[model samples]
Target chain A: MDFKKKQTEANLKPGDRTVPERKIPVPHRDISERAQEMIAAPYNVFIDWNLNPPTKDDWSKIVTKVSESSAPAVNKLIEDLGLTVEQLQIGGVKCYRLTPENIPENHRKQLVIVAHGGAYVYAPGIGSVREAAMFAAFGGYTTISVDYSLSYENPFPGAIEDMIDVWRAILTEYDPRSVAMTGTSAGGGLIMATILKIKELGLGMPAAIAPSSPWADLTETGDSYKTNEWLDNILVSYSGYLGLAAKLYANGNDLSHPLLSPINGNLEGFPPTILTSGTRDLFLSNTVRSHRKLRRARVPAQLHIYEGISHSQLSFDPDLPETREAYGEIAAFFDQYLIW
Target chain B: MDFKKKQTEANLKPGDRTVPERKIPVPHRDISERAQEMIAAPYNVFIDWNLNPPTKDDWSKIVTKVSESSAPAVNKLIEDLGLTVEQLQIGGVKCYRLTPENIPENHRKQLVIVAHGGAYVYAPGIGSVREAAMFAAFGGYTTISVDYSLSYENPFPGAIEDMIDVWRAILTEYDPRSVAMTGTSAGGGLIMATILKIKELGLGMPAAIAPSSPWADLTETGDSYKTNEWLDNILVSYSGYLGLAAKLYANGNDLSHPLLSPINGNLEGFPPTILTSGTRDLFLSNTVRSHRKLRRARVPAQLHIYEGISHSQLSFDPDLPETREAYGEIAAFFDQYLIW
Candidate 1:
């Protein structure tokens, strides 16, 4: 339908009254055409047209697809770095780990624990671990990537318990305030839950946390869950989140319980946190809501929302200026809060 | 009051049961010994203390004392910078202007128009104007400090009219997206009012806003008015905020009107905002409430509460790292959103 017809049908004021007609037209030739096309299309259609899904498959297919696709890349990256793999016992669970020997001795003193993401369904792989090792080396910090139990195998408390043990080991070895925890997606949720657990256990909180595109609320009540339904480019719909993994992780437990959905957790005294997400990411609301909760709890929190980027794009394209800038900011936050 | 005595009198559980005895070892240190001493003093000594009016003499003296003491410091730091100033006709009122040259060119070319703080009773002076110039220089934005009519001389719409005129001039000169408005105390309220006026006038929205230690609600519904009481070193007590100046600024206006209180303002579509204040600051509640309102409105907003810092300390002690960091973050935010 035409603009006027849609306005009339909706009983809304004319377009001129709502949004003034641009006196100076859009500069780019193609942009104007695109703008016109967008204005002509129904709002939902426009949203869907702009939607960019990173993975085009059902949840049942996701694990196998990711495992197969990421394996070769992970293997090649790990081989190129000549990293050594090791096993560590954490909270009575054996976790896989990797340490790069090329890292300078000075850098090996400061530890960075990487909690891999996949809504708690996947293990820390060669792809993410190699990147974490590279970042830790470059940033002059010793890094360990946790290969915790996934929801498909053990679920819920298994992952949480593994993380707590890893954290406890770190604390026993180094000052708690000097430690920095980070992750993306479900790993982000783990970071938040880890901090919450530390506080509840009366352990000293970490100096800082950086969770990118975090799946904060497994329950999915964020307005963006509904508002950015098709506009998001990654994690296409909340169904992959709230519908599938949430049930899998819950193991028939209450989804709204703070332990399952950290967004519902009382955020009174978490450490300084930095949350990053792209506007086109399906988990945008997860990051935004988490940031809001952290702020309300009087925790020093910083949130950076990139306008047009997609989820996990930063990790995939670390050289992009936007990605580098986002990581740089997160690193800077860690630098300020994480002091050994 | 001793915990054991209070618990016994109230027929409540003993403190040892609720709180571990190990935590109660330093009970006496927690009590205010100075307060106890004061209360135990002779009746004659107490009478003599009350007779002295706490060294300031009276309310008028208190206001004058603060204004006079703060002036020279403001002037020495700000006015000496030689910022470019102009007198502009705004809303049929004369408004002082600090031009682009006053700010560092490399920072950003955005404009920041400021309304000075004086509880709407005092006129803009060398101190506030200088502070604005310094802020522009440090913040890397062209700043126009409004010398709006004050309440003692001109009431209600008089200051609002001047602000509206200055905003009109800014709109005419720059793209609204390239401009941000800010203020401290009463000026903070004016910034909120200016936003409402601009919205009502159908002008484009600004990119961002930062209101520091704003006296948002003249009616003083903020719990700090009672709770902070003597603990707040500045604004000494709520009476100074609610009794005289609040009544004067209102000029019979509704106390809860968002324009007057602005803590109650409808915050839809306003620019991304950052608010800063100190825990002990008198305007803590104003900042908190404004933050809550902005969040409720779904406007991207941030609030930073600095521990132990008093009212306007960030501006006052710009040389301090914390102050510079806080302002630097604000400048960075404006850089991100405000495209020149």
Candidate 2:
């Protein structure tokens, strides 16, 4: 058939913005072709949500399943990195410690307190271990990943208070200057909130900190909320999973409460910090805003935005060339402050 | 040191965008971090010019090294996926054919012609087998990859002539409707140029084509040339490496010639086509423009832009969710026309 005839026959409105009528005749393949394609690949690395957020009840079920078993992943990390995994009672709250077998002598005293991020309610115990183990393996740091209380069971102050509990315990043993904090997504927001809470409680701050793509804005006020809505798959739109998680965590409290939304917090005396995020990350604006805030406060901060990466991809494959550059940047930054 | 005092000591002009005077005191590692970051993940997956295009002597040396061994990669693919690899001489030009162990009976007659990208100089011999084997393994299609001549010794029409020579032989054996043409980077441009050449030679066109981030423009006239310059690690800027490759391939020929620079070509009667590129891809503008041209011609066209990814990341990892999605989209599109 001629090009014009095929065009009319297919009946595709080439310029139409609408989903073109499926006149393109494609034959379906066998089940085997579909089976061969499944390679244990996890779904979207970024969150995915359309215009409306999920109902409260729907989110509750989703949270439970994601939180259920991260143990398998934790065990894999332990075996892969030859790291020691131990549980510690931090101010009565339990936290996991992941220390690599070979910590290059100088990095011995420095411990990174990891607050794992899963929008506040998911990926608790094993999440902390898996994330912390990579930090240990990549940066050669002993780590304490705080398994803070979740918004699912305790809501609002529960997670922040638990983060404080672990922070208090760490400060009690390690010299304030010898310690540091790091987190991703909600865990990242917790890091900023803890910094504020520490100041409020008259506790000394750590020597340095790194918050990788923190969900610092509880409200969908950042530019990326709209620009990166669909670009970021896992967190499709700000008002979806993130908003649902925020409402559940806030549990009727003001979304902009300084502790609840770290973007609104007072960031004074924040330690020399390094932050990371990706361009397509839904929380890219959140991360960018936080970096601007730190810069405004005249805090020495380094922000590394990996091109074309999604949320938390910096920590995804420790061996990926970009991932190594990311953590290597953190290790170099910490060397100046925490090595003492 | 007190936080307030250390802040002054560090002397960070947070908002000052003057590259920060480098006083952050990062101990330089063995390759300046910048130097270490430059790897030819095929550079642009289609274009790689180190600093400057080589003189005749240098080009000869570089070509020999790259052509020396693609065998190991081909062997690995054969072992990994139960696929058969065979060499064929089409119109006296060498090409590689890859076929899956079991072709679905209905689709056995259809085949995909791959034009491998290597700035027209690299990845010849086993490059075809490694890339084509994956399509056979994943998409269940027999793939024939043309190992076209490069500009190092044979410039301008050398590669395009070789591609047409192979295409002519393939068309003689298989019905034009039974074949689909696909390429990446330079090969993508080759597909467009060849289509124009095919029309000139009065050969029947293939049913469809898919070009993954084609180096469409031979000149630096695209918007992304400036926007995605430093952002795209591999193809840092159009003026740098791609420019050199374009110059070498054009060999002082008219760049605006439709056959030499496909972006300038008439896309009328073009086959149903799909194009892929990343947001950070330097050729993003090239891909977007080509899609526009096809759409203007009312040729059915689909473009998939992977978020924040650099050039040609679609084929970088066979197992990445995005890569799978990229290929899946093509296979589905091809099935629409090729199955009949």
- Model 1, A107-214: lDDT tens per residue? 345567778776676443454464465455345556677877777667787788888988887777888777788888888888888877887899877778888888
Model 1: CA > 4 A from native: A1-5, A8-65, A79-87, A90-92, A96-108, A123-131, A240-242, B1-93, B96-112, B115-340
Instruction: Compute DockQ for each candidate against the true complex.
Output: 0.02, 0.02
The per-residue C-alpha lDDT of model 1 at residue B199 equals 78
What are the C-alpha RMSDs, in order, of all predicted structures? 19.8, 22.4
Candidate 2: segments with Cα more than 4 A from true spot: A1-340, B1-49
Worst 10 residues of 2 chain A by lDDT: A17-26
CAPRI band for model 1: incorrect
Instruction: Give the Å shift of residue B63 in candidate 1.
Output: 39
- N/CA/C clash count, model 2: 12
Q: Give the TM-score of chain A in candidate 1.
A: 0.78
User: What fraction of the true Cα-Cα contacts (under 8 Å, chains A to B) does candidate 1 also have?
Assistant: 0.00
What is the lDDT of every predicted structure here?
A: 0.60, 0.68
Model 1 chain B worst lDDT window (10 residues): B19-28
